[model samples]
Target: MTSTVEVSPAARRSAELEDEITADPSRFRILTGDRPTGPLHLGHYFGTLHNRVRLQRRGVELGLVIADYQVLTDRDVADDLETHVLGLVADYLAAGIDPDEAMIFTHSAVTALNQLMLPFLSLVTVPELQRNPTVKEEIGHSRQAGVSGLMFTYPAHQAADILFCKANLVPVGADQLPHLEVTRLIARRFNDRHGPVFGEPEALLSSAPLLLGTDGTKMSKSRGNAITLGTTAEETARLIRGAKTDAHRHITYEPGTRPEVASLVLLAALCEDRDPGEVAAEVGSGGAAALKARVTEAVNGAFAPLRARRAELAADPGYLRSVLRAGNARATELAEATLAQVREVMGTRY
Candidate 1:
């Protein structure tokens, strides 16, 4: 008998939702995107960008946010964000996101979207914000030099980003479920207090496994472990070569014990769209050199097309700016409509 594993409620619900979406995608709207703090990376590509392209191809409406203002949440790490936002658009285009279809805009550019934050904050209690697992985790970071107020109200802002476009489906990772729950609560409370101004959103949990850094920890740009999308082929190989590995000669996909090796293997597998087990077996007995070579080759080959597209996009900065402006205009229209509803429902339209 083939072995079987039990699925969780969230996974089952997500499956049902995907099936419903696949059958009638026109009825659904999706809001998803990235922070423009830095370059896109392999982890980000596998994590959500590819999924956005997949949904977009299926004729789904997408409101992709380049949350530039969110970079201030930390209050300490902000650099060249406007430039980074442009680079981010280039990456999105290179990764097959059609500018004509997806409404990609910076939240800071949308006044009405940010304005919703004040009303949204009223829907939730202080204890609830403090209780949000995701926020609590981020607040834990305040022990160093302390985080900014933006850090505290980030979930509300995130809810605004999602609900502003009246997006019903949000693509999130498992770790983000708690945060999404906060958004769901806000929507529920608002709808109950006022008229039906918003739809309760649900999560589309990514099937992509968490990709750890080369050092066997969370992949981070500041940590210098992330292989950014725009890194040169030579730089990619160098980074992979420096990845943490073990002395064991026979390669195997053991994430629990051999996390470093497993991360590299997973990276290669994602690059080539193969199973991690198969990737490990293919590199069996070849050791770290073989693993590094395979990962480097796979990553470089995968990114080659995107890199060329990005370079082409970079040459036309005016086109990139126009895309942002157009998206901002469209997003502003949607946000204005939503804000009008919010004001009317609250009887604060005077």
Candidate 2:
């Protein structure tokens, strides 16, 4: 028989933190980011981008990092690094991430943040790194025979990214809870050894439901199963048209028994901001074809505005570069101050 462990006090506290909304958004500083390996996708939109836009609108201090260096942990080729990074920026803009409201910077641009990662590396052990669920899953998915040192230590680097700006709220999904736990552990350990120089960041679980790929599997860029933000309306329709669906003649949202159809129904509901069951009922007796048509329509409708905005943004390459440069400068200013304090605390200021 298998055994289950009770949730730790810290984990329990982190879960509770998600519910406590800040009345004054300015008082809440959030650090959330994505690796610039590919363009943002529908999964990215519902999973994190939507919440980021909502939070930025709420007047929160937001720092968005384009983790360029982190992409090298698993892959060796970065032939189009600049293009991919700019694509991410354009996607962010199209998804309502205001450059003026949220600071968007690339990882390599912030040199001081990397310097802060050294001491953090010493705070965590290799076994602890191996134990992190997120790391383990990524390694397994990548099917790498051997994990790189960078891959092993990326979590520590992540801690530095969050602490550099002293962000107290990190928006993430439930599956990412372990990563946040590791970040909080690093913070507590550093404060205990050096001083209270970092805030123990809390995880703000995303309210968005997990979105599956059209093939009824986890959405992934490597798998070519993602519906990218830059996907055109016609491409979106084509993808949905080819998506898997059961032979059952009636549409239903029973996830367990009808996952493929349920996935499409979920996507439709999210796109239309309607209940999944309600959407399923509306598509009654119309069968797989009916569900596909509705899903295609909903998805294309949602992407139309985003596609237009992204096109406009992509057409102005100079403006995107300037946004990244300005963000880099802003991030450097804040990161340097934090690094200086860290050096002083560790008596390495010389």
Candidate 3:
């Protein structure tokens, strides 16, 4: 049975805000990022990375945060944290995030940003934190016997991330609206308690098409089902060819009855910027093999340049480190200014 995903009231409000921002994209500052647990995947591309690139092209002041510290919230140890962080930098550059235009920094690297967490934490209560759906979902996924204090209070840290940069806009998916809501609440409370210091950032819902995993589930690296941005064209083709599809020979976009095949159709549609029904119709009785081939070709063609760029960027680790150093320096400057304003407003500037 096909289950319907319910749209929350927050998500609806976010959609309206997104429309308002769409009219004047440049007037707003955008802050978005990923956790550097692993290399980014096609899901990252369609979900937010592509939108970041587009926003940068439009001259938006974009702040990309690699939440490296958050990666340790659920885990006891991460030996390759530095490697993952650097890998994330390579992926962003390879994905067309211009270093000169956008400020990409690691979460831990910005000292003042991390310090803001303490003051922000005081503004939010445990019950309010508990209400965050994203946290609840993550806890459920981890299924740990006990939740760490860091994990429980990570939403506040996210508030610090958004508020520290003074970001007026944040790009997120519908499922992430609750998390954004928490950030908004913290901003409102902070402004109310101690003058207006931070912009109440609104969610810029990503318009990119959502691509399911090869196994017809949500794409995730942990699940070993994601097609990473770093994957070679040959490997991409192999993975797509191995993707799950319905036993029915005929191809159609019947998401309710034939979700597996429907997903491939959706991927093809997004890759070609065409309607899923239209693509399905054009593919017409070609069966799973033909549909898979089309999806493979579209995906490979779309990512060919990205793969090439990523390879070159990956080969020069020193260059990537220098980029990160530059980003960190830029981020620290902005963060220090914001934190100073925050301290002045709270009468703690001394």
Candidate 4:
């Protein structure tokens, strides 16, 4: 495990965030995943997935859960779940999440694992659930529609995912800090009652910017503003063309003043390895029309390799399945060990 005994605040936040969970480096594991609702977009890349790739390559033990069941809790968009999962798998592979290095499995496949949620639910209180930021945010976004029991109870399920793998580090954005807190609370409670069997996974926060969608809102596939990883070059250009930008008729990198245009410029800079301010100046030199075109070109160029890699992997569905199957087996090994520990802790072993 990398030590962060000395580093600047920003560097500490960015690269050396695992100091929180180095208490037992050998037992440290990373738990993270996508809901598999839609093809992963640029938002996920910058948000969490990119970091997963980096950490996994550096020998981080990771378990990615395909929260397929969570999709139905909110809505009935059942048609594309499988496709979305496969697409996500492809995205992960394309982004360098080696199947051998990390375990990737779906929620539905882990029956014994999901069973842990029942006992785990008893370990947490309703007040704690209500205090969770993720749950509260989901309720607020429901627009007065009654929140489902699953939505309220999903945190326990998440706890199952984390503790089942004995994960000690959870990569998350600032918004997800509450969910991690709930996981830690559950771990503490379970250990207090049972034994110190699970590690309290600390939040491995990222320094990457929380990217906004094309519409200047937090990026989400459901919001229709996302630029999915599966996006074609033409689609990316079209989104850039229609992306929300400031009306100053010139480009600038002031996110406060020109969020829409500035976001596009930043994406361009990220792709081109140039300064956003420089990109902004170029856009300002030209009109928004020229700026949008430049941004589009830069983005297309940047994602070209990833686009090709994803397409190649998508061509071989059997390869994707094999990867998931192997990952499922590996995940099961870790999960069964945790389950065995749980059974022993509570004297439930028959």
Candidate 5:
């Protein structure tokens, strides 16, 4: 007799949402974004940004947040916050994210949206917040401050970001599914107790394999392993040159046994739009040096257009500011409408 394996509720929901997104993506409103801590790297390009672009093109109403306020959750100061925020906008524009198509705004810019946090907090308990894996991981990274209040309630804030716009779809990697659980819980609890003021957002999971940094570890800017979009072509080559790889002369794309080498191969494959195994086979016996060379070439070629576009965007800071202004205006409009609904249900309109 064969025993049936159990599927997780999140997994089951994700599978169902995937079909909906494919069937009629236009029916979905997707809320997703990144923290404006620094420059977005290649890992982010493939992991989230690229997927956002695809979903937007598919007619999904996408609201991309800059998460500027969240930058302060772990860090003590965000002195160059403006630069990072604008830089994020430039990167989005460069990466083919049309401002006309997707509403991109910062956390601080949406006051009404932030106000949703108060009521949302009531829906979730402290114990439930502590149980969030993403929150735990983020807290682990920031040992300097121990744990900030914002950091502790991050999942709730994230839920507010989602529910404020009544977004039904959230594109997230497998690891981030835990964060969405908090959002779903808050939405459900609020609707049952207060009223249906928010939509229970489901995860639109990304199928991309985890892309490790050059050092065969997590990709991060601080660790100097990340190949950021702002990096020069020469810098990319230098970084790839120093990447950790096996001593095997013949290359093969087997991530389980050879993650480092497979990562490099994956980079090349992502750039050239080919299978990792095929790219690895083509570089047969060429070793790490050759693999790096091909990756460098492919990466430089692929990002050339984006780099050029980014430069044009950077030159016109006024245009960038206008884009932000428009996004902020749109975000405020949505938040105000949601806040009105929330007040009506909670009888707090007075």
Candidate 6:
């Protein structure tokens, strides 16, 4: 047994400041959002979502925004919005993003966020949007109606998502740097035109290497390669068993020489705390069958806790609803505060 230590108010404040400084001495809020297009996958887990959980544990204030409205840029169907959003929430929860540590809210929940988009639009130019790499990939020129106004102005919405939360850090991939650059520009423009109310958030580029799907392409739901967090243990095992691997009778972890074996090696390494080289050596000695067996076991073991928690959470729909409701209220409060400042700066204040 150990004695509990009670901190004084001053000491508590100092400790809080120390924790924030430890996260980043510059003390910028972190804002990240995911479009509720589909359930999250392994790529998401190792890439950024894992980092989000780590950040939350490190005492960083996290705002996990569900970009529900952003879905309309490509998808016109409203038939599955509720299902998608709820599924996304389940995925997030399953991925260890505690609602107590992070505020999980949808874009549509905060109505005033839309109001911030217009002024942010004025701050960024057309050339900037055209230069965005993701926009190019997401909305290729070959498509009919090459781009919608919403798609064209997605940077503005991204800006709103960050500045609305007064986020100092935006975790993004290499392809999303341009989006953060635009957000930085908008922050400076707003500060210059109005006042120093917003801090230009910096991008926390993910250190995790891009994990491809089983089909040897991007791990996306559209490609059917994604192993969703909501998937059952049996399902996860089945997917891993059926996953593409090298045709080599024996296993070796040479990414250049054996891409398929290397892929499983990497996955096993990521799921377990073991090193890829070590796992590879083991597989190389034992062969592909042994590698597959260990890989399947590792995947299941890694996902076990999450799957159990998700089932527990799923059983109580009311609890999940309340959590989302609380998150929405907290998000609305923050968004409204930011919007009030925006209105003041834009001279919209009555």
| Residue-by-residue lDDT tens digits, candidate 5, 1-350 | 99999987767878887688789988999999888878889998988888888888877899999998888864643788888889999999999998998899999999999999998898888889988997788777885747888888899999989989889998887788889889999889989998877777878778765778989898986677999887889999999999999878899999999999999899899999999999999999998889999999999999989988998998888999899999999999999999999999999978
RMSD, one per candidate, in order = 1.7, 3.4, 3.5, 4.3, 2.1, 8.1
Which residue pairs clash in candidate 2?
none
lDDT of 5 at 245: 94
TM-score of each: 0.95, 0.93, 0.92, 0.91, 0.95, 0.88
**lDDT tens digits, residues 108-194, model 2?**
999999998999989999899989886787788765678777777878988988999999999876778889888899999999999
RMSD score of candidate 2 (Å): 3.4
Residue 49, candidate 4: C-alpha displacement in angstroms: 1.8
**Candidate 1 residues 1-350, lDDT tens each?**
89989998888889998998889999889998877777888888888889999999998898899988888764445667778889999989999999998899998899999999998999888888888876788778554476667878888999999999999999887778888898899999999989898888999988877788878789876677898888889999998898889889999999999889999999899889999999999999999999999999999999999888889998999999999999999999999999999999899978
The lDDT for every candidate, in the order shown, is 0.89, 0.87, 0.85, 0.81, 0.88, 0.78
Candidate ranking under TM-score, highest first, comes to 1, 5, 2, 3, 4, 6
- Superposed model 2: Cα runs more than 4 Å off: 1-22, 143-145
What TM-score does model 6 achieve against the real structure? 0.88
**Window of ten residues with lowest summed lDDT in model 5:** 71-80
Q: Which of the two, 4 or 5, has more lDDT?
A: 5
Total clashes for model 2: 0
Error of 3 at 171 (Å): 1.3
User: Candidate 6's residue-wise lDDT over 198-219, tens digit each?
Assistant: 8878666566755667766668
Better of 2 and 6 by TM-score: 2
Going through the candidates in the order shown, the clash numbers are 0, 0, 0, 0, 0, 1
